[model samples]
Target: MMNTWITASAVAVIAGVTGFFAVLRGSTFAAHAIPNGAFAGAAGASLLGINVIWGLAVFAVAGALGIGALGRRARHDVVTALALVLMLGLGALFVSVSTEYADETYSLLFGEVFGVSGAEVLPIAGLGIASIAVIGAVFRRLMLASAMPEVADARGVSTRSLEVYFLVVMALATSMTVPVVGALLMFSLMIGPAAAARSFTGRPGLAMALSVAIALVTVWAGIALSYRTNWPLGFYVGVMGAGFFLLGRCWAAVRQRRAVASPLPVLPNESGYLPGLIALPCRRPCCAGRSAVPAVLLCRPLCPARASAQPAAPAAPDNFPQKTAAGLLMARRGESSVCDDETSDVWPQLWPGSRRTRCDGFRLHRRR
Candidate 1:
């Protein structure tokens, strides 16, 4: 029982860490498929009377490479499905031929945490340590590649190589987890805790720590409950993992609602406006003449023209056309010929007899 607990705890930590990256990289389907694919190796090894660990490692690495190679042309889900079907079929074929150890085969599909031998502890710990060490070494590169592969590539990070390395590490982690969690239920431990952690926090490091802690709690609680009720460990683990994920989602939703209801801080310059008030574009004909102000003044009076005609209102900014004020004043006075040189060129085409004035560069002549 002690050995089983140790192995399960180590596997949980490894899975939790790897699962964080798996979710970030959008490879949950691959994570699920790889364990089942590696199960083929266990089935074959059982038939051949050899160590199942070597077989699992070999098949998992092969499957990872196969998926990576095929993923170039096809979608990852398609590639993963094809690989899963092929491996599962092979496992079924192997199981059919083997008459002895049928119960062992069943245990492999489900799990036999209670049956863990003392000798298995060292190897499991070694594998878990190795996986953690590799993850730590490539943490930054993996994060960069997972978030934005194109940007990582532009920054001279070898995204392709890092992807292959990550897949290999994931393969190792999957193989290590299969014996404790079973091939079918391994994805629960891999994704559930990590996903819950992500829902609770946006920071990657904090999320990872939370994921590991959640996984540890889930595994320990599952083991305790299984021991008390004589239920399957995997069942307890799955239920608790799912529950934590739901709790995290609820927490996140509550936070979001609180954020939406809270008042936003006003900028020092925007004291007159209420917090959270959106400033809209002034669309009155007077303000519409100037396109330089993209969007300005929220729900204020539309009579800026009357104020502009007076001396108190400042002149339009330099970006505005120089003739805009004259045009507005002329429109008010019921007169014309306020066209600037740029406008004069266009005015002649519009009004055939228009003449350009030297005094103010106004075009006065109009069509008869």
Candidate 2:
């Protein structure tokens, strides 16, 4: 039982780190392919009466290097498709021919941590430690490359070599984890926490830290739940991880909404009447297509027809068609920068037909 906990922990940590790089670099499908390739290799080894670990590691590494040879973006989907086909096809073939060890093969696919012994745990533990160290040493470079690949390359970082290195590390981690968590579940362990963490923070470092913490908790909780309820450990771990990710997304969304709703200070010399812009808490539905602003306002009170008859005059700073004032207002409120395109929509709705006269050629309008 203790061995079960240790093995699960090792698998979780290895997977979490690999997943962090995978998601960061947008190589998730490539990382996923390694385990599928390993499945094919493990099945083939079983048919030949060989060590399944050797087969899994051999094939997974081959697949990783093959992807590296093919180039990163172009061959990613192709490699994943091939891996899936090989895994399922070889798995079926192995089952049909091996009547004697059918249960053992299935156990290998989904995992049997209860069968892990102290001796078997040592090798996997070593692999896990080595993977963690390599990940740490390359952490900054990987994050830099992931977020800004072109900038990183311009600054003398070898993006291609780093990609290859990341894939190799991912393959090794996948190979080590397959026997403990199975191919299908291994990827969930790898990607779920990282994905969940992303929902909580835009900062990659914070997300990675959150991912590692989530992985640890899920592993321990899965073991405890499985032991108490006689459930499969991998299934429980996956469920808990997914649930955590959903919770993170919900939390992030709530924070974003709050940020948007908070009041912001208007800049001096900025006019109160921002032109043709939509205000917050608007009922108007926004979409890809154009929609007319049914109502409009100008600081001046005049009859609708007179307002329409008057020459389209330069409007107040905020009331102008120019998006600068609204952008500044949003920035002062501590929210994410609002896109000019969105401000464009709001501008027409709020000011109507104001034009900018003197202020850096910014145009403003009042409702016609």
Candidate 3:
């Protein structure tokens, strides 16, 4: 049981990390294909009387490289499907040639995690850590290429080279995970947690952390539940992965609803511009300007002349068309935004003595 835990956890970490990149790059089909199709390699190795791990690694890496070499950047899935078909056909050939059913080779198709030997645990964990280290070294460059391949290529980032390296690492990780979770259903364990984490968070580092954590929890729960219920471990892993993805979708939907409920303030229009108007610093201890902005709330109106002769004006009401926010002054089109008081400096422009005047589009009085 302890050995199973160690091996499963290590494999889960590798899958979770690589799955994030897989989702970003839209290489999900490849993720699923390589591990399952590589079963043929194990079968072939069984026929040759050699270690099955070597066979798995060789075919998986070869498939990745072939896909990289033969497929165009945007059309890799077509080539991936062709490779999967070929590998599965070869697997059948290998199995048919043998005189007896190879129990060990067949078990690799579905994970035999509960029967893991203690000797294999340390090596699996070590390989997982090494793979993670390599991924981290190129994490930034890979992220750029996956998210914006055109931009990365335009900047001379060598996106093609990056894809090859990334695919190679993915193949190696798939090899490691194949024995623990079975080739056919391994992608469920890898992709589910990763897709869920991405839905929950946009930051790459945080999403990756969440992906690893979710994968561990899913694997642990699967093993424990499978032990008690005696059901297939893959069944639990698939259900748990699907459930997490749905939960993440719910969270994202809720956030989107909240955003719609409260829209940001609109930008100022031409009417908001206080044209040709020079602002005199208010020395008047007024309650607030016409806008009622917080800064001058305890102070006074915008003009300095009002406070010396009379009490401060009240804070502007919400109904006032003038708004002193959003980096613009607001008012009705063709209206002066100053007080009507006769003694005010800006007021003269509003209502000149007996004569009609226009103040910043304000028609103060009728023409004589």
Model 3, position 90, has a per-residue lDDT of 92
Tens-digit lDDT track for model 1 on 74-174? 88889989998888788888878885656676677678888889988887788789888999998877875675464355447887788778888998787
TM-score of each: 0.70, 0.68, 0.70
* Candidate 2 C-alpha lDDT tens digits along 167-274: 888998887678767876777787889887777665555667788888888888887888899888779877987898798768765654444211112222223222
Tens digits of per-residue lDDT, candidate 3, 69-164, equal 887654788899999889989988898898564665656777888988888888889988988998999987787667545435544789888988
- Candidate 3 matches the true fold with a TM-score of 0.70
The global Cα lDDT (0 to 1) of model 2 is: 0.63
- The regions of model 3 sitting more than 4 angstroms off are 102-106, 260-368
Query: With candidate 2 superimposed using the best TM-score fit, by how many Å does residue 314's alpha carbon deviate from the native?
Result: 23
lDDT of each: 0.68, 0.63, 0.68
Give the C-alpha miss distance for residue 8 in model 3, angstroms.
Answer: 1.3
Name model 2 segments beyond 4 Å from true: 72-75, 87-91, 94-101, 260-368
TM-score of 1: 0.70
TM-score computed on alpha carbons, candidate 2: 0.68
